[model samples]
Target: MTSTVRRAGAFAILSTLSLVVPLFDPVTAVPVAAAVLLAAFAVTDGPLFDLFAYPDDYEDGRLYGLITFVLAATALGLVSVMSSMSTAVFVGTVVLVGYGNLAAAVTREWTDNPASHAAAFCVGATTAGVAGHAISRTLTGDPVTDTFPKIVFLAVAGALLAALLRDILILYDDPVVMLAVGFLCWLLAELVPGLGATEIAVATVVTVAVGYLSYALGAASVAGMLTGILLGLLTIVLGGYSWFAVLMSFFAIGSLSTKFRYDEKVDRGVAQENDGARGSSNVLGNAAVALVAVLGYAASAADLPLLGEANPELFLFAFAGSLATAMSDTLSSEVGGVFDTPRLITTLEPVEPGTDGGVTWQGEVAGLLGASVVAGLTYAVFPDVGLVGAAIVVTAGFVGMTVDSLLGATIEGTAVGNQGVNFLATLSGAITGALLVLAVAVL
Candidate 1:
């Protein structure tokens, strides 16, 4: 038979074996399950993905790649379910949609080239929109999410405005970042370190409003978005945030910072041909991690035993620390970028603005100020411990920033690179924040 026929035959088999995978993979599949599954399906059945197939010369190799993807996805999906029943189902739905498209794209004879990847992404994007609609419904459930709808609407809408207002607004990255960080905030909850979804959503909306108003109003150079997010979160802690403060803070800072030091552009490094799709994947990672973080937050917010009840102060400290870290990171990156002479953090000598471990007077000050902003907001939320918490967060955040810089400079794109280091950066930041809060409270 022709190679085309053979390739088509393999693809068809992959679609059929979709269910059979779970049996062998009841615990875990082979190294590259997704690609393996696809390849297996194709080789055994014929007609890949039921949508497209390999070039006559590259059929075998394509099958290998496709199977690896399937196996990985299955493993990922299962793990997601272990975390949250709802999340698992949600991810599963996405897989189902993707598979259906895989089928169509296959029968339609789509290849696993850039075009196919894009087609897959389109399917995923559509799935996200649908998921949002579902979330809208969930938010408005019989009992509703209570404060959620207002929070989501306010946060998402607010951020959009901020992006639009900026002289050089980056709507995609900021929102995507918030969306990503919000999710990361969720995952951090697994550490029993937490930030609430309500607060995050509110922070998001408020940040947007603040950023946009700052920009549209032509006020601050950097817009001080982190200032707005913390402020918004603080308002929520006080039961609800007022828009007036958000707008005022962003505007005041935006307008006041006339000298303008840092360039607030998303780094060129972040730019890639497949950035949109990669960004989308990162968002997925965010979703998983964020949900966990949200769980930790909800536990605390609701005064639950394991997370919140253990030590309210500790939980509070965690939240403060995370916020401070985020703020410091943002401010440092933003302000530092604009500095005329950034320097090495360790040496205190001049270096490039975007260089990891590099620091500048402008950036350091920005970092300090950023931590202070979050700390101030923390005070506004729970006045009794606000100052202490903020101080802890500030110290921790700056340290985290320094560590992140070190990690980036030393290993991020280099030979010593490791994912473990990234986690360590986060842990050190949280620990720094937590320790500081505890130390002061002891006094």
Candidate 2:
């Protein structure tokens, strides 16, 4: 087909997809987009923008885009295959995972060897998560639920039109790219281990709501997209689940504690919110452990060993524990940021909110109370957990808070390539809590 015809065809297909993908879930559409992007990249040179519009004029842009497309596809494809993953094994997995990892690598300013490592880690970790979540969810007949792909594409299309009409610089921070990344991340989380449909739904709601609120509040430039995603998820938790209510309460105490010389952290705008999302260590760390636990359950219940049915109770218990830890840590930073007064977590010295080892009086007190509330309320979701499990959930929050602070102070966001302390901290807390209960049973 002629170039004009091909481009026209692509646009037509994309338009059709824009309409249909939403109904089936955007994650499913991601793969096809990725494939098309790859083909476009193959035909281009270096930069991404130039590739779609004028590849001949920008060979460098076309070439770079091609490289990225190939590498992303290759990396995600291999990881998915290696894990023998189920949920994300489909084409959608390749597209979303590729897009997500590519964004992370791109944002990290990865180049040469570091680029490969970033790709490897991002794709491998993501695949592991998908494999783990799928194993358990499928076993229990629960499916991953989300529609971010369509939301992102439509947002991008809208953004592109606005940029074209305004004749402004529609440069790097393209809405389309962000939408793609966000949608991809949503899919990854759906298939993530220690994750569930409930969490996915909560995240989607939070992102949309917060995005709208930020716009209403006039945080248009900074809050319109990504911030909205974060807030949307938060809203879902606060609005839909009692688990978040308690956690938010505890975080409020933690933030307030800093004012009374409890913990000091000089609070700011961006750091106040993103420190948790970008810096959390528990995300990937605990996911690995959850995979094992859920897989074991899946193997047992299905009577097919590796393909066994999942015991819903055990899976729910695991999911709640994981969600509890993540929410607890996130709420801590958010609530803590509400207060101006902050203290050092290590020595009770006053420090910046962005500073590691810093705490706040209001944040700490509120954080704890919040955690206890989440633990208790989350337990109510699954009768299998009983009251004892409730204690474990609350305890995990405390543990997660301590681990997150300690690591942040001592290692997080500061280490050379050890950028996962927060994720690890949360993971540590959840797995520790889960294992503690499991160990108690053994004894």
Candidate 3:
């Protein structure tokens, strides 16, 4: 058999193991099975490795895909056993991972078209969702109608995420897709019970429209559009459209800033690459922290342990702060690069406009303006967030901008990339926003 056929067959056969999960104690059986698989794969010359591994696996001297799959399965098993997640959901995730990959592999062998691979994976995801729903209904005796919508939503989300990750990531795509799908299932079960068909439909329509509009505006590339859609859906579903608007505000301000003095920036060789069409990295670096804060706020609403104990409002503030920081940093770098002769932030020495860690008064003022815009939006969106909260967000944004400059001056190029500094700066802004909220409460 061809290597592709062998891989597909192996995935199909191994995925069936999920069917027997209900018969065994997942807590014990999962660990023992995982241990055995690890041992088997550890043997380089083993039949299991030879049969299941890919060409890249030989180059890496290990079965990376299989190892990731095993790890993902083990994680799902542990979550199922510990949480209120049903065994059927775990089975569904495993099937989705395996069958989805199998379908992709087979489709790839036939044709190299990306759209075809995505369609095939979606089919596999839908099949897994149906299987999971049937098993849940059969085992739990729940009304079929009760879980159908959520399961269907999960399937659709899994398909989108799988397609995006498969297209973007060079490795570990399957495991990440599995974990994301599993998390979505868990969220549906535990946190967002109100997310029925209507909410899903609305979220999809709004996100897709916004994503397309952004792409048309040349603010985002194809990958950026997909990432934005996913993140936009999560923000709307977890928080609300108002929160999503906050994110859009950042995107609008950043995009406009990049376009400001576009010709001059290009002449100086400081313009954003691809005329400021954001890719996946740019989207994730700027917005991931804000997304995490939205998730945290959702968890707080659901009263999930440590995250729950904190005031949910704190997360909202953090969300604003993160976005504010992103806008500030973008404006400072993009707008400042065109207008001012910059000085190094660490030392008072003149530097090129595009130089890392460069600072100019024009940039600082623009950064503050960017922060103020987001903070004003925050105050407008949430009535409870008074002037004090808005001021805190602005302060946090400025602090994050300073942090970014400091990091750029010190360790950015040597130890961490630009994205890492952006992430850290946003994280700092988030923490600052949250802490200031707490301080106000304490005082």
Best by TM-score: 3
lDDT on C-alpha atoms for all candidate structures: 0.43, 0.44, 0.80
Model 2 lDDT tens row, 269-320: 4233332222112223423333343434434444544445544345434544
Instruction: Give one digit per residue, the lDDT tens place, for model 1 in 1-443.
Output: 44434443443344334333333333443344445654555563344433333442244434443444354445444554365423322232333333323332443344544323333433433343233324433533422245333333333322222222221333112223223322332232232223456555555555556544543443322323323333344334332342234224323542343224322333433111231121222212212222223345545655655763655455455555544554555566656666568777666677655676677777678867876775676667566765556567678767766786677666666643423343445456666766776677689
Question: Which 10 consecutive positions of candidate 3 have the poorest summed lDDT?
Answer: 133-142
Candidate 2 overall Cα lDDT vs. reference? Answer: 0.44
In Å, residue 121's CA in model 3 sits off its true spot by 4.0
TM-score of 2: 0.47
RMSD of each: 11.1, 12.1, 4.0
- Rank order (by lDDT, best first): 3, 2, 1
Q: Which RMSD does model 2 reach against the true structure?
A: 12.1
- In candidate 1, where is summed lDDT lowest over 10 consecutive residues? 277-286
Better of 1 and 2 by lDDT: 2
Model 1 global lDDT (CA atoms, 0 to 1): 0.43
